[model samples]
Target: MSDTSLLSSLLNLITTATCNLQSELKGAGLPEPWIDNASLHPWDEETPSKKYWDARRTLISALGMMTAVVQNPREKIICDDLGYHHSAALNFIVNTHMADVLAAPNVDERIGLPVSEIARRTGTHPAKTERVLRFLCMYHTFQETSPGVFANNKVSECLKKGHPTAELPLMWADVGFRSATAFSATLRDPQTAHSMRIEDAPFGAVFGNHTSKSTSESESIPKSEPGTASPVRATIFEFLSRPESEVYRSAFAKTMVTLDIMNGALGYHDLPWDRWDKEGAVFVEAGASTGHLSNDVLSVVKHAKFINQDLPEVCLQGEKFFAENNAEAIRSGRVKFQPNDFFTEQPVKGAAIYILSNILHDWPDNEALKILKHIGDAMIPTSRLLVMEIVIVPSLSQSRSPPSAPVDQNPNDAPWPLPKDYGIVNRYPHHQSMEMINTFNGLDRTLDEYVALFQQSELELVEVHRIRKLVSIMEVKKKA
Candidate 1:
């Protein structure tokens, strides 16, 4: 079809989908998600509404597809493909505390602030601040209320100090950005390219304590002992565990909380928590950082004993977290924090439910298998394992033939297919997978891979509950 015809067809499809979504939202008595001031906030604060979020996802997908078709291919590829510039700008804003400046109690939210004021408060150059703010404003993160005066919008508000998600961007823009730079090198280095060892990954190569060496020399160097203090031998987690890395460790923990928020309380939505016979049931939260997931469970699934396990330092923090947030549960002997390494053994045995949220994805298969084996050893015949993680969908091959035109569809139908594996829906996860490989030599597995992992532990995969676009709850049990 002609370019103009294709554009028209896409526009029609977007319009129809958007109208239908709006109607559904109205019927459900939810607020309209306006494009100008969209509230993509988590729905966990209220009752979990799958229908509402599903509608929102549909609208977002359609809008994304429409945007792709509307942009000039050359400009789009150049601007969108090279995202480091945007990341750098955002990193600058985060590191300099520009968002905190705008959010100060004395600052007028309506009047906004000029570049001079923002730069002064942030200790940045006025001209550079203007350029960065203008770029961010274009992306709808910050807004220019008047010429040269910027204020926080919903998007920028996320960066305000003490926000639940504030530390997430910093994690990405700092360590994530640095690790990404070494991605190309990781791919090209024969010694490291295909290696699943954490020390061989780009993140290790960049931040690791090892001395600079050529690929050949690196081969001769003895592998650093796990949990050792050697500068050259420490894994990402080990490095972060050091006394000097306390700032980064705190940020990383907060980032996990942000991830949970982003997933819209997936565990609660996907798992049948209400139906679970909670009377005297033990819920073991393995690798529970700050006890956020355990807190979620305590809020919903009452009368259950909770064990929050992690490394010693993390368990200490989790204790404080539960003390501050769920003091009643701790006071009543329903909740306890235990410091136990997953790699060592299953300290809590035969729990009714063991939750491994975002844990296995941080390790390679070899390490992941070891962790699984420990969990399996702890499981009773009736115990269920809830492995919450992203299930990556394979991408279409470039060599595959172009999608054929619909045989008998209305002309107003979407010009492009709306398959779940379409580029727009899959891109974020794909990027995440790459980051996993780069940072930890880990992976976001497909369903089959997850099943295989469970099978290795002599467990049976009962079901997979999709919680969101990038996450799922793979339910497993001891093999009958």
Candidate 2:
């Protein structure tokens, strides 16, 4: 439709609403400026009449106000909610198990299977499965790259088990199972919603071991084999394995990768490698693991040495990844990987360009300061440090296309009686991100937060860039 027609339609809708309200108020027998002045615009409340235009004014106000409210939103959630279920939504999440179905590595189109086939393969009901799949595509949860098939989104990718989007789903799924089996609420709180908080948990409360409850009712079952152990026992064994299990270690790596991604991780693939000097300065990535992007940097900055460093476990992963890559690279001879603990008092020398990716948010004020001081001490007086982290915007109120929901809590909930910065109230991400970080000793910081963190670390921000559009990259130099 043309703009003129669209405008005419809207004008008609408004005219009808206004006229209806005017008639209702006139009938209410209210004697007021409303009745006397048909010419008075809604805003002209300056002159009052014997009967204040209460009814007409209020009704018109609502009509006018709703316009502003409606126009503010980006996407209108369909009034009839989609029949999409939890797993249906999750399975559509990026890079997780679900991707295996809707898409294979090479074929990006719809899997061309009937509902029965899809259900049989995924173990879902035919009709319901088809409905959910089609429904998510409606909201762009996944795109129907081909008819009856789906592709990913930044939104969905952001929700992967490793992303901020991954937390609530994972947390609720794990705890929700326990709640269901509670069968009748063995405890109290018969009236209110169940409230429990898991904090500082990276990767959004994967529960160190998030798995389903045992279906086998064999209560007296003993450890016939450790592999057959119950979930609780398996959890205990995971802990017993202590940072060694591939699962636990993967969770750790996944969490950092997600954090870095959220904090605007800029991979080596995205860098202007053709322009960067290979030997200009070796890029030392502190806490780099698997060298996923660091290796890309090495490839790009051929003259620049790429150093990927992290803890022993991550170092091993990096070494393994590099070694695997090296088997191919050695034939071509490029890029090197080094293993070192940043915390073990190694002098930060020779590295002209140091990178800290998604590191500061994990520590509290004092500890973060200590790490910064270590970086400061190790840095050459003139060296530069590139620190990447999420800078909390003071009020997320503006971020909302239509603004936040009424129940949405304020970001700055005013910590006690202290000043905002002193209280650190604003450094928090949304409650969703907070839950994941709080499960562990991690946090999301603001610009002021980055400054405070940087000052402590003996680095001063020279310029800050919002990389990948979302992650804040701080170019810092040693404090003069």
Top TM-score prediction, candidate number: 1
By summed lDDT, which 10 consecutive residues of candidate 2 come out lowest? 414-423
lDDT of 1 by residue, 203-275 (tens): 7766677432322123334343223344464577876777766666888898887777665554465567765
Which lDDT tens digits does candidate 2 get at residues 1-480? 222333343355446545655565566554333221213232232222212323233334344434545563434344323322554355333223343453344543333345465567666667776676677656655554455544454344445343434543433333332222222332132321132212212222223344432212112322122112223323322432464344434545655544444323233244344533535566677777777656545444556666777766667776676676554542343445667766656444757677777666655566667667767777776577777665666541222122235455343332111222222222334542453232423567778878877876667898876333234577788888
The per-model lDDT (C-alpha) reads 0.73, 0.48
> After aligning candidate 1 to the native by TM-score, how far in Å is the CA of 455 from where it should be?
1.6
Top candidate, metric lDDT: 1
TM-score against native, each model: 0.86, 0.55
